[model samples]
Target: MKILRAEEEEALSEALRVLSEGGLVGFPTETFYGLGADPFNPAAIERLYEVKRRRRDKPVLLLLGDREEVGRLVEEIPPVAELLMEHFWPGPLTIVFRARTDIPPWLTAETGTVALRVSSHPLARDLPRLFRGPVTGTSANLSEEPPARTAEEVAHYFPEIDLILDGGPCPGEKPSTLVSVVSERVELLRPGAVPWEKIEKLLKSFS
Candidate 1:
């Protein structure tokens, strides 16, 4: 696997080039390193699952550019969820909402709910912007293996990836906080960078 320096302009250009070809790229995020692919490409998504040995039942999270994009993916956006997105997006919070028909069932696990995040990491932000649509942000390690925090760790874990963008060690090095907003009820699926107390407070704004 080829390793590119973090934030190196040439590396970014090359990474985009590989992604455009429907190949996989590994890069660092505010949390852990993630294996990314064109979310709209079913074949690419299949490769991702095969690489991680992940089950089809587990849906992948889409890293978005902004809140406006979120509206396009989900059929409805709750008011409280909006506040959370506004306050914590582009940081480390992941919000799950009812996805629209536009996204394929494989990406959303055939469930109406889809996880979306606006990453704060520069590489994470640029990677998605370079793609036709949002890219999958699942961890680079094989299923049940500890998530990779560095580019080398990712390369070691998934050697078959087409490209590796070594953007140094992941900062905060934790997974994005995950919350699901369904039927007006907000629930925390996994707490990572954003704590539960803060998320609960945001939910109260809706009440």
Candidate 2:
């Protein structure tokens, strides 16, 4: 495992290289340090599950570079999801959508849905954009443990990580609010950085 400053000229390329080859990279997100794996690489995802001690039954969420990338994941964006993405994307909100049939079941834990977010963290957002694909956004820590707030914490948790882009300490706040727009009833899977009351108000605006 190696720690590289996030601003280092080679950090982005190195991360892309590791991810492309189905290796893991530890990077900072708006809320915490997360493990970056090629969302398209099932083998890498399996490794991620093992590294984090995360259960395979719980689907992993993905981080996107931007709002437009949603097309690559979902078949149709619900009207509510559209509005939420307009207001909350590139921030701390993860919206769940009915994934494209072609998306491997392993990625979604056979749930047939995928959770995605566009992070506001500069380095975090750039990683996926440069990778040209979604990156696993699961926090870098053993499952059921507090999420790691610093790159060092991530390294300590998993010493075998391929690369770690240290973006310094994260906000260390509540994680992104997770809501599902897969059906007419918008469901709140996790209440977090984006308040549910605020989102409920937005849902009311849906005409």
Candidate 3:
């Protein structure tokens, strides 16, 4: 087990290196520790599912640096979704969009929509940027296990992970709000760190 300083570029590089080589790396996010692997790599995604004992029907979130990166992964970025992105990105908000042809089934869980988030946590944001492509951003724990709040917790849950980037405890003991943006409006699927009232306000402002 190894703990990488979140701010250090070497740590990010090392994690990315392992991911590029199809290895799993557990890292911190604003919501919880996430087990990361190359989003485009089907084998790596499968390995991630194996590590977490994740359900094939449940989809994984794709973390990116900014809107442009998000745009690249999805089929279309609706105007309302853009407004939400402008306010809530680099934070705990996930917008689900239709997947592009390039997105893998492992990512969307055989669904046409892909879940995406631009995290606020520096290391969480940096890890995805380092990869320069999306990495699977599901919580680091076995299926039905509590989501890990610290890297040590992640290590305990996923002992076989190639590397564990311990970035201390997450900001809050909660997950990101998830919304589907494929229709004329944004629909909240899961209530999380970002409350439904706040999302509703954002939608009203955009409308």
Candidate 4:
């Protein structure tokens, strides 16, 4: 396992290289360190699941650099989703949307929806932009294990990963709030960093 300073140009370059070759790269998000892989590459996604012992039926979230990246993966961003993105994105809110028909089933767990977030962390945001594609944003730890908050923690949990981008400790220890907008209505799946009341308040304004 190679541990590199995430702030270094060399480390960023290596991360892009490893991800391009369908390898696992452990990097930090605002909430926790995550196992990053090319979401579009089936092999990479498979490797991610193997590394974390993640369940096959569970889908991984996609981390993006900007809202424009959503066009590549989703069919359309509902108005509610757009409002949420404008207010809560680049922070700790993950929105699930109907995916484009061509997206790999593995990404959606056959549910035909993709969870996406525009990460606020510099490393999380910059890496996807540098990769020119989305990357898996699942926590870097074995299934049922505590999420990694630092590079050292990531190494302790996943030493066999191709690279660890050490960006110091994650700002928040909790996961992002997950909301699904599948049936023209917003559904709260999991509430973590963002409060459900806040989301509801925002949505209520549209009513």
Scored by lDDT, model 3 comes in at: 0.84
Q: Write the per-residue lDDT of candidate 4 for residues 1-207, one digit (tens) a residue.
A: 899988786999999999999899999999999899998889989988988998899989999989888988998888888889999979899999999999999999998999999988888999898888888899888999889898999999887889999999997557999999887788999988999999999888878
How close to the true structure is residue 11 of candidate 3, measured as C-alpha lDDT? 85
lDDT of model 1, residue 120 = 91
lDDT of each candidate versus the true structure: 0.84, 0.90, 0.84, 0.90
Q: For model 3, how does the per-residue alpha-carbon lDDT over 1-207 read when each residue is reduced to its tens digit?
A: 566777666888888789889989888888998888888888888888888787889898888876688778889888888888989998999899999987777788888889999899887788778678787788888998889998878888878878888788886566899999889488889899999999898777656
Q: Find the 10 residues in a row with the least total lDDT in model 3.
A: 1-10
RMSD of each candidate?
1.4, 1.0, 1.4, 1.0
Answer with 1 or 2, whichever has the higher TM-score: 2
Off by over 4 Å in 1: none
Clash totals, every prediction: 0, 0, 1, 0
The positional error of residue 191 in candidate 1, measured at the CA in angstroms, is 1.5
Q: Which ten residues in a row have the lowest lDDT in candidate 2?
A: 198-207
Model 2 lDDT at residue 73: 91
> Compared with the true structure, what per-residue lDDT tens digits does model 2 show for residues 6-121?
99999899999999999999999988898999988889999999999888899999999998999989988987888888988889899899999999998999999999999999
- Give the lDDT ranking, best first: 2, 4, 3, 1
Mind giving the per-residue lDDT tens digits that candidate 1 earns over 1-207? 688887676898887787777789998889999888888888989999999999999999888766677877888998777788878988889888988988789988988779999899888887787664688888889999889988889988888989999878886456788888876677888979988898777667656
